[model samples]
Target: MAKRKGTVFGVPVVVALFFLGMMMPTSVGISLGGLRLSVYRVVLLVMFLPMLITLFSGRCGKPHLFDALALGHAALALVSLIHWGGLQQGLESGGIYIVEFAGAYLLGRLYIRSSEDFRALARAYVVTVVGMLAFTIPEALTSVHILHDGIAAVTGGAPAPYIDQRMGLERTFGPFDHPILYGVFSASAFSLAYFVLAEKRLTNGRGMALVLGVALATFLSASGGPYVVLMMQAFVAGWERVMGRLPTRWKLLWALFAVIYACIDLFSNRTPFHVFVTYFTFSTVSAYNRILLFEFGTAEVARHPWLGVGLGDWVRPVWMSDSMDNFWLLIAMRYGLPAWALLVGLMLGLVWAVGRRKGLPEPWKRARHAWAFTLFGITVAAATVHLWNALFVLFLFLIGSGAWLYDARLPKRIGQPPRLGPPAPRLRPPPERLF
Candidate 1:
C-alpha cells in the first residue's frame, strides 16, 4: 500500500460525516442482544475508525483544549460519583452526559483547521438541516393520515393511535427522538445559515434562500428557545455593526454599560422574569416541570454547596424531581459549584474571545457572531430543557471552534495593522540582486 498524502479538505469531510451520522435515525438498525445499535451509530463508528487509524499513524495533530473540555466533563462526572454515593448512578446519568460532550469535542477537533474548514463544516450543517426540514414538513402535515393507516394495518381496527388523544399533532421528529429536538436543531441551523449568508466571502442568493427556508422551519418548530436566540443574535449583530462605526473607547464603554445594565436587570427581575418566561415561552409540561426542577436543584445546591449532591446524582431526593428540565440546574445539582464554575468559565472565555475579535475577516467574524448567538440561545433553551444531548453538544462545539478561529486570526495590536513593516516592494528585484 502507498502512503497517502493528507489533504486539507479532509477536516471538513470528517465534520460533515459526523454531522450526517448524528442526524441519521436512531432506530435505523437492529438490536444485538442488549446493545441496540443503529445504522447511524454504526456509520459513525466506521467513520471514526479512519480518524483513529490516522491519529495512531501520526497523521493528525494532537488534541487541544477543545479536547480538554471533554476530559473536564468526564472529571466532573467522576467528582459527582465520589460525592453522591455510588458509581452506578453516576454512570447512568453523568456518564451519558460525558459521552455526549466527548463526542462533540472530538468531532469539533477532528475537522476544524482553518477558516475555510469552519465555513465548509457550517455549510454542511446548514444543508443537512434544511434538507431534513424540506423532507419532513409535508410528512408532519400528513402524519395524522399516515398514523391512521399504520395503526389500522397493525390492529385491523378503525380507531388508530393517530386518533388517540395521547399523541398531539404528529410532529416530524426526523432523526431525533422528539419534535423539540428537531426545533432546537432547526434553530441552530437557521442561525448558522444566516451567518453564512452574512459573511461577505460566502454570501449569495443561494445562501440567502437556504437561510429563509431554515428560518421558516425554525418558526414552524415553534421552539421558543430558538426564536429567542434569533432575536438575541440579531441584536448582537446589530450592536457589533454599530460598534464598528464608533471609536474603540466608546465601544468598550458601551459594552460595559450594557453588561452592567444586564446584571442589574437579571438580579432585580429574576422572579417575575422567570414567571413571564414560564407563561409565554415554554410548553405547559416543560414550563411546569422546569419550575419544579429548578426549585429542587436550587435546594440541592444549598444543601451540598461544596461537592454537590455528587455528579450525576441530581436525580436523588433533594435534587430529585419529576422534572429535570433546566441544564444549568442540572449542572448545579450534579456537579456542584466547582463544576458549574468550570462550565461558566468556559462559556465566558468563549464570549470574551468573540467580543475581543469583533473585527475580523468576513467568515471569521460571522462565525464568532453566530457562535455567540447560539450560546445565548442554548442558555435560554437550557432553562426549559436539558442541553446534554447531541444538539446542544454540537452547538457548544461550534461556539468553541468559532472562538478558536477568531483568536487564531486576531490582529497583533488593539488597532494596529497585522504587519508593522512597510508595504512590499511593487517591482521585483533583478535576479542578480536576489543573491
Candidate 2:
C-alpha cells in the first residue's frame, strides 16, 4: 500500500520482485541438496507462508473448485512421480513442481483481491514486457542473448545457446529458457494491457500502443506457439469489439467452428487436429514432429492410464525425439488422466464461472474479459506446444488471479442521479401528505 520505489503503479513490492525474478535467466540460481533454487523460486518461497495464511484466513473468500483442482493436480503429480521414481528422487522433483504450481496460484489468489489489483497486475505485465524489449530487440538483431551470457558468466553455469533460425533470423528467446516460453510470457500480456490498462477501443491510442508493444515482443520469439497465442487473443478481442452487440455471437462462433470441424473430419483423410498442426506451424518438420508426438503420446497415455510412466522415458520411434511439444498429451503421458482432467476442469470451470457471474461493475467485466481471452489463447496454444517452468507456473498464477471475480460484489447504487431540471414536484416529495 505504501508508495515506495519497490512498489510501482500500485503493484505490491513482492509482486514486482516476482516479475523481475521471472525475467532473470534460468542459469541464475544455486543448487541445494540436488534441488535448484532459482530467483523466482526464492521469491515464491519467501511469499509461500503469507499466501497460506491469507488463503486459510477467509480473506480471499471460500476456496473455489479451481483452487481444489490446482492442489489436487499438484498432489497427484507428486504421487505419480513417487510411483515411478523412488521416494527420494520423487520428493525432490515433485516437491519443486508443487511449489512452482500451487505456490504461484495461491500467491496470485492472495495478492489480487479486487479488479483494481488485477489492473495493477496488468500494468506490471505491460511494463515488464516493454522493458524486456530493450534486451529482446538486441537479441533479435545480433542473435546474442546478453541476459543468458551475463547471468551464466556470474553464476558459472553454461549459457543457453542460440536455437534454430527461422526467416533467416535467430529466435529471440530473451530471458526465458526457450523461444516459445518467452513468446508465451510476452503474449500473455496483450489482452491484459489492452483491456485492463487502456480503454478497449481502436481510438484508445495508449491501449493500442501497449498491446502493440506486447505483440512485438511475441513476434520476436518467432515461434508458432507464441504466434498462435497472440493471434488467438487478437481474434477473440476483435470479435468481442465487432460483434459485441450480438448477444449470441459466441454461440454462433462455436457453431461455425463445429461445422468446419465436422466437414474436415468427413471430407479429409487427416483429422482436424492434424490439419491444424500441418497448416499452423512455422515449418512442416515442426508440424510433422507434433503429429508424431500427438499419436505416440496419446498411445502412451492409453497404455498407462491410471498413474502414467511418470519421469520414465516414453516409448516412441527410434528416430522420433523424446521431447513432446503438446502440453495436454505430455501431462496425460507423464502424470495420468486424472491430473490432466483436474487441470482442464479447473481452467474450463473458472472460465465458465466467471463468465456466468452477473452484475459485476463494468471494470470487473473488462477484467474478466481480459483474463478469459488470455487463458483461452494459452489453452489453445498449449496443444501445439508444451509449457514448463516459469511459463507453466505463470499460467496457473494468471488463472488464480482471475478467480476473485467469481465472488466480486456488484457495484452498490448509492441513489438515483439528480434531475438536471427543477426537481419533480408533488409526486415524489408529498407521498406521506397524499396518503
Candidate 3:
C-alpha cells in the first residue's frame, strides 16, 4: 500500500461532524414525523448510506471477528426491543445499532488504513479536544455554560445540566451529555495523542507538548474518570519497565493467577470489573451504590436470560440511580450476556492482537501497545462512566481500527517486498538479441 495523505473532506469529516454535533440538539437538524435529527444523526444517516453501499459493493475493508461480534450485538438489541413489546422502538434501536455502531466501525476500518492515516485522525481528534476545552474551561471559572446556552438558543432543547461539585471542585460536562461522558471523550483523545508520541511519530518536543496539552484538556473537563486515565498514562512507562523484565514463564503464571483470582471473586458473588468501580468512584457511598447497581444489573440479566429487560429506561436499581455508569453491564442487562460477551471478546482479542503484531520496529510496536493500554483502561473505566454520543461512536471506531491492526498483513508497496527476501531479481533482455 502506498502512504496516504489525510483529507479534510474524507474520513476526518465524520470526526468533524461528531465534534460539532454534540453541542446542539437533535431538533436543530430536522423535526419531522416524530424523528428529531441532530447533526450527528444526519451525518450517521448520510455516512451509513454510503457505507452500506461500499460494504455490499465489495469496496470496503476486510471483515474481522469483531465485525461479526458487532452484528450479533445489534441482533440481540433488536430482539430485546421486540420481545419487550415495543416493535416500533425495536425498529428505532435496530436502526441505531446498525447505522450508528456498525457504520462507524466500518468507517474506521475503511479509512484509518495505516499508521500515518491513524496519525492524521489523531491530529484531528486533538483539535476537537481544543474546542471542547474552549467551552469547558470558561465554564469552570465563570460558573456559566455559555456553549450550552448558545447551542440551546438555536437547537431548541434544554441542555443537559449534569454538572456537579465533587472532590471539592466543580466538574464541567462541556459538550458531552454528562460529566463522566466528557471525561471519556477527553481521555480517549489524550490516548490517541499519546500514541502518536509513543510511536515516535512526532518529534520529541512536539510530541511531549501535544501529549501534555491533551492531558491538560482532560483536566479542564474536570471529571474523575479522565483523572484516573491520566494517572494511568503517567504510570504506563514504569509499569511497562517492570513488566517487560519478567520471564515468559512468570508472565504465564501471572495470567493463570489472575484467571484464578477472577474465578474466586465470581463465585464469591463479585466480578472483575467491579474492581474498577471500587477504585474509580468519587466516594465510598457512590462506590457502594455501584455495587447495588451491579446487583441490579446481574439480576435483570438473570430474569431476562437471553434478550434482557429491553431498551427502556435503565431499570432504576434504586431511587435516583438511573445511571448504570458502566457500558458493558448496561449492554448485558439490556441486550443479554451474549451481546456482552461479544463486546468483551472483541476487546480482549484486540489486546492480544496488538501485542502480538510482528515485523514492526520496537517504537512502532510500543506505539500500538500504548493504544492497547489505554483501551484496556477505558474498558475498565467504563465501570465508572457511561458511553454516549460521539464518545460511544469513537469507542466503536477504536474497536474497528484495533480489529484491522490485529490481522492486517501490513501492506507492502508494489515494487518493494516487505523486509527480508532476496531482492527481486533484476531482469533484462538476455545478452543482446535472444529475442
> Number of clashes in every candidate structure?
1, 0, 0
Misplaced by over 4 Å in model 1 are: 1-11, 28-70, 82-96, 144-170, 198-204, 241-244, 247-276, 279-288, 310-321, 406-435
Q: What's the true lDDT of residue 358 in model 2?
A: 78
CA lDDT, every prediction? Answer: 0.59, 0.86, 0.67
Best first by lDDT, ranked? 2, 3, 1
Q: Model 3 — which ten-residue stretch has the worst lDDT?
A: 1-10
Clashing pairs in 2: none
lDDT of 1: 0.59
Q: Where does candidate 3 stray beyond 4 Å? A: 1-6, 9-11, 22-28, 56-58, 160-162, 198-203, 241-276, 312-320, 361-367, 411-435
The best candidate in terms of lDDT: 2
lDDT of 3 by residue, 155-209 (tens): 6757666556654545666655566666667777665666665343445777667
lDDT of 1 by residue, 14-111 (tens): 45555655564453445654444444345444555564454346434554453455467657756676557676655555544554454455455454
Q: How close is candidate 1 to the true structure, as a TM-score?
A: 0.72
Flag regions of model 2 displaced more than 4 Å: 1-6, 414-435
